[model samples]
Target: MSRGLLRSTAVFSAMTLLSRIAGFARDTLQATLFGTGGAMSAFIVAYRIPNFLRRVFAEGSMSMAFVPVLNEIRERGDKAALKDFVDHMAGALCAVVLVVCGLGVLLAPAIASVFTPGWALDQPDKFAWTTQMLRITFPYLLFISMMSLAASVLNSFGKFALPAFTPVLHNLTLIAAMLWLAPQFDIRPFGLAWGVLIAGALQLVLLWPALGRLGLRPRLRAGFHHPEVRKVAKLMLPTLFSSSVAQVNLLVGTVFASLLVDGSQDWLYYSDRLIEFPLGLFGVAIGTVILPHLSRRHAATDAVGYSGALDWGLRLALLAGIPAALGLFLLAEPITATVYNYGKFEAFDSRMTAISLTLMSLGIPAFMLSKVLSPAFFARQDTKTPMRAALLTVAANVLLTIAFTTPLWLYKVEGAHGGIALATALAGIFNAWLLWRYLRRAGLLQPQPGWGRFSLQLFAACVVMATIVVGLRLWIGSWTEIAQPTHRIFWLFVVIGAGALSYAATLLASGLRPRDLRH
Candidate 1:
């Protein structure tokens, strides 16, 4: 990547790290306050419904489509047209999502029933809570989706940090709600749902001033039939699946998990959160920065810059993603036990969460690869190929979920939810492979030289890091057996820090350098 782009990515990643830290605090509070089984599972169901779709239309597909066109407009140097497009898109998205939110709120019970039919059948109380929370949280899709639009605009203009930092407010809001508000409710999970609602609106509000500073504050002129608007609409249709394949697979797991034991949903949800930490901190930052860079490169017809950016993103993603995956897989138990096993969240819950976390960690590389690869397609306005790949990936996910989870369910496996996670991981690998294959076949991605050396260095570092982490982890015995939560937390960080230092040292010794990442 160019030095400027690298700086932007770093800015975004640093801000994302703050947000992720805040997110850990929020998750810890939620686990301690709400635990896993009944109402937390209900909240997960309700939250995932809208949140998954938010990833689809907001950060995933919509930005993929919007950024390229927005870059095209900006490249034309027509400020009026640029502002017009932003305003119209703002109004159109708001109009559409408002209608969808209304429908979601109205259909809350039916939506809840569809996702958790088992709850409806046997656990009516959980079903009712799902519906209630869904009613409260559905509108989050509207607010957060708009916030993403604002963020996309900010990113296209090279203002990465504000957009990246906005998520911190979201985490803080939830933390506050859990700490102060949850205790007031007769049913505390209601506080979580309220937090979701408030966070969405607050995040959007938080970005408004940043938008104004850019002279791009949307005035909300509805223009669905406008040519640019129609083009974005056309693009969004295919990406509905293509952009959010992982989230789609997770929703599939959620549906299947509903039929399993009570806490299966929570187990899957918490494990997914753990895996998302690395992804959000790095994979997403790469994707977010690269999209606009690639879009501008495409608009300028800079093939060399485009390919270099793609190459750089792939190399960086692997350097961070592979080791992160291995580290998470190695430390799943300690990580889960330290982060979650508290208050009402028992050791069994932590153990179950670790099972899923370990399995899901396998998908991190594929997930990060797709993060970069999908944007390569989207940057060039080529959504169809990824859409086709996404279709097959999701189909494979469903089949694999059944194949993996069915036997676990039949045999009465203790952590049947882990099978759902394993299937998702495998499906993600398939999805990334498909995207990579598509990119290669199209002759759009030409790997820069030294890839073989890069691969070897990554492998060497991972092996070294894994050996050290495992050695220390074994020496420490078990995380759940630790007497104090603080002690467990302290040791987990020690192991993680040592592993990170070893990985970086090995990489440096193997001839990987900061300069190599720049060019």
Candidate 2:
């Protein structure tokens, strides 16, 4: 990363950290209110429908497809032309989102059934609740897709803070719902669904002024035949399928989880949410900052800049991901026990969630690598390669999900949900491996000098961090046995702070410097 890129990434990461903290609070409240129960499972699955679409169409596909093209146009120094392109793309995307949202609402029951097959047949109450919430939450796709589009535009213009902060609105809305609206609802999670709907609108509204400040506010004019819009359409098609593989894998997990015991979906949901903390704070923040930067370099045929960006992103991902993965693996139980394990959430539920979190933590490196690397191909307008990788990943996940989940389910194992999380984690590595392999074959990503030493140093630091966490865990005893939540929270922070401090100290002692992160 260049200093400029690093600064931008830091800005985004800080905002994302705030958002993740708020998200943690929202989730903690949700777990308190619902626990790993039928209602929580229903909301989890119902919410997945639009969230999946948001990833596929809004953020993943359209944003990736739009940024490079927009960057090129902006680089050409034609503000009027750029504005025209933005308007046409906005109109086209909004039209598609409206149609999709309408269909999603209309077919909520079928959509609910497809993702949660076990619920539709054997768990009718869960099924009905899922469908109802799906109908309420599905419009989130429309609002959030537009929000994503606006954010991509801002990112392309080198404006990242507002976009990064938008998710805080989402978490705040959900937290507010949990505190107030949920109590009024007969079905408590229903309030969360409504909150999703409201937050989507608020997120989109929040970005309009940012766009206006840039004098790039879209006019919602139909121009499907505009050359740039057509190019974006072509790029979005394969990218949609390609970039959505992760979401697809999650959907696959949800399908299998639905068939497991009653609390399986909730377990996976909470575990995945915990896994997302580090990912959201660092992995995604880095990826978001890098995409437009890579797009600009790729457009200018600046191979050196492009390669350096990729190298920096990969190394930084490892630098951050390794410690995070290790910390999560070491402190999974305590993290779960502290963040959840209140009210309706029990010690058993915390144990199960921790099991899943630990298994999922094993894949953090792969997940972050994929998050940073995919944009390399996307920036070069090569979505087909990633689409191929995504297909293989989905297939592998299916086989693995079945392979790992069958015995657990058949034998009635205590932590069967962990099997699904384990499969997802393993499949993520395969997906990331394929992506890295393709990037190598295409000669798009070249490792920068010092990578070998950097890797060694990173490994050493992570080892130190892991040792500290393990030592702390041994000294503190099991979290569930702790009498007070406040003490559990204190010890959890002690372990995390000590591990982080040790990791940083070891990295410095091993000759890794702040300057080493620079490209």
Candidate 3:
């Protein structure tokens, strides 16, 4: 890898690590305060609806369409054309996001009714809290969408550190709110919602200085009719459908989870959060840094560069993802207990959540690989193919959910959360496979030599990590009479540290080196 790409990846990875840590703190706070109950479920539902929209409009569709085109314009056009295109797109996106958010705020109750009807029926107070929280946080969707646009521009300009680190600001703000401000208001969970809005504003403000540094001062322009703007709109439509399908499937799962039991949504939410920590840290950071580089290489017809970038991304994904999946699977119980076994979160809740976490870990690699691979299509501007794949994945997820849930419901499984986790994992694997096949068929992705060796080494590392982690957990379990939380946390760290050291030693012994991570 070039020093520039490595530097960018490292910077982004560090920032992502901090953000994920803060996110864990935030989740820990939520788990303690709300536990596996109606309030937590309502909060998850409220937060998810807008977040789902953010993914569709802001993170997924908009960035995928805007970044490559912006890069192309920057390469071909003058400063004036670039500024005009950004201004027009920004204004148009702001208008659309504002309108949608307005509708969301106004119809928060009704929207909540449809997606989380069980909450509305059984826990009126929880439903009301969710409605109000949604009203406050809905506007964050608009601000963050604009932030996504600005960040994409900066990233295309190769100024990745600022945009990548800006998320840390959001996480910090939420952590502060949860620790300090929320208690002052007696609406602890609601305070987190307010923190989200403030964080979005902060993220946008942070990027504005970066935009100015890039000689781009965005101003509202009546240029929706601009041809370039229209092109972005045209590209975004299919991508939106593609992106929203995944969100829709998740929302459907949430609905089913709501009906399952009181704490089911919370269990699923916590488990998903655990898996998402690594996914966000490595998968998202790598994807963000790799996309523009891949797009540029594809645009320049640099086949070797494109292939190298893909290879490095896949290799890095395996290096980071496989160990994470194994660690989560083996230490799910201890990790959950150590992080979240407090306040209203009891032993039973931790056990249930650990079960879900273990099941979800099985799909971590598949999920990360999908994140890494989908960009191959996006870089080539072939959104239609991924859209088809995404739709098919959603259908498969729905069918699998029904299939799995039926048996679990019939047998009254101890933690019925396993079915949801399994369904999601199966769907994710399907999604990854379809994307890989499509990219290969389109000639956008090619298999590299030594993949067999990479797989073998990775498998060996996972085996070593899993064996140590499981043995350590068994040893710790035998000493359950340890009275202090400090003792528990200390032993947890010892086991985790030893397992990590073993994995690292095994990887090094197998001939994988830090240099292999470079492009």
Q: Which model, 2 or 3, shows the larger TM-score?
A: 2
> How does each model score on lDDT?
0.92, 0.89, 0.82
- Per-residue accuracy of model 2 over 1-519 as CA lDDT, tens digit each: 489889998999999999999988888889988787778788898888789899977889888889889998988999999999999999999998899989988998888989989888899998999999999999899999999999999888788999999989999999998889888999898989899999999999999878998889999988689999999989888887678777888899999988889898888889899989888888898899899989989888999999999999998898888888888888899999999999999999999999999999999999999999899998998888998999899999999999999999999998888888998999999999999999999888888888778878988888888888888899889899997889988888888999999999999999988887875
Instruction: Compute the lDDT for candidate 3.
Output: 0.82
TM-score of 2: 0.99
Writing each residue's lDDT as its tens digit, candidate 3 over 1-519 gives 455677887888888888888877878777887677755676778888888898877878889888877877777768899998999988889888989999999999998888878778877888898898889889999889988988889888878778878778888888887777777766577777888889989988888777887778689776579898888888788787565554666777887776676788888888888898888888887888888988898888899889888877888887888898888888888888877888888888888898889988888888888777877777877788888988898889889888877677678777886788888888888888998888788776777777898899888988998889888788678323465778878998899899889998998999988776663
lDDT, residue 214, model 1: 83
Give the range where candidate 3 is weakest over 10 consecutive residues by summed lDDT. 475-484
The top-ranked prediction according to lDDT is 1
Question: Cα deviation in Å at residue 30, candidate 2?
Answer: 0.9
Give Cα distance to truth, residue 133, candidate 2, Å: 0.6
